[model samples]
Target: MSWGVATLGAPTFLTIGLLLARDARSDHPFFWPSLLGIVALSNAVAILRVNQSHRRAAFARRSVLALCYLRAGMAAGCAMFVVLGWSTGALQEMVATLAEMLDASAPAIAIVMGTWSLALALALAFGLASFAHAGALHAWIAFRRGAPGPRPGA
Candidate 1:
């Protein structure tokens, strides 16, 4: 259930972050750093909460699950970013610039840029998706604790 939630939630959060970052790029120089800080704080809080609630082994498992979700989210988010860029001709413009710089063909430049963009997107998505997953899990944990029924994991 967590995996399913992360699979959908991570990409959605990442796409939103990308859009916000794109908008902030033109105006706010501090946006990226501020966003990164927020994500870091969120992850820290989530880790601490999980650590306090579970044994070491369980914490490790949860950590691994979160990492897996983060990677999946990053890949999905990057695909979305590429599609959006292509639709907006942003990718073409970037490719054109790089192609001129390296005297390469447009297709080659596109492939290279696409690869680079994936890497870049992965880095950006790491924090964004991590925060999303952590936030989601945190909320879930809170709900589970508040519910009247017995807790399976607890």
Candidate 2:
């Protein structure tokens, strides 16, 4: 597995940890932010690999699959983080931030974050699954293209 795929494990583990350590009024945020940062950096590396023209032919199909899988993992991890964040008043913080930016109150902020998180989580799930499917399809195409020619008749 590429380093990009390998690094996704960190975010997944952090999200699991956050879920386990949920507290409504905790002062310190879980490692979720660092998890996000790590995933983002991994994706940046993958993007740079894809953008390198010299390496394009060297990794055409593999690169595409890696990128798709990376995106799927990233979306799934972030969605899971949001779900875990909601448990730790990060949801509240998110709402407060939005409300401050828009000049509103807590309840209004709750409604906004609640709805947005729900919609965004569902959308992320859908996108992640779709990207995974694309990666599978691409893999199948590559496999078929690389098959050995038919054997000669007896």
**What TM-score do all the candidates reach, one by one?**
0.36, 0.38
Candidate 2 segments exceeding 4 Å error: 4-26, 29-60, 103-154
Error of 2 at 72 (Å): 1.8
Once fitted onto the true fold, the runs of candidate 1 whose alpha carbons sit more than 4 angstroms away are: 1-60, 103-154
Give the alpha-carbon lDDT of every model: 0.48, 0.48
Model 2 residue 49 distance off true place after TM-score fit, in angstroms: 20
- Cα misplacement distance, residue 53 of candidate 2 (Å): 25
Q: What is the C-alpha RMSD of each candidate to the true structure, in Å?
A: 10.4, 10.7
Across 13-127, the per-residue lDDT of candidate 1 in tens digits comes to 4664677667756333443334344443444444455444443334334445455434444444444445545555564565556545553455876767765665465446554
Decoy 2 TM-score against native: 0.38
lDDT of 2 by residue, 1-154 (tens): 3333444434343454466458433354564454455354534443443334223344446555556555654555555555555666665565556545553455866767766765465435533532334334333333222335588992
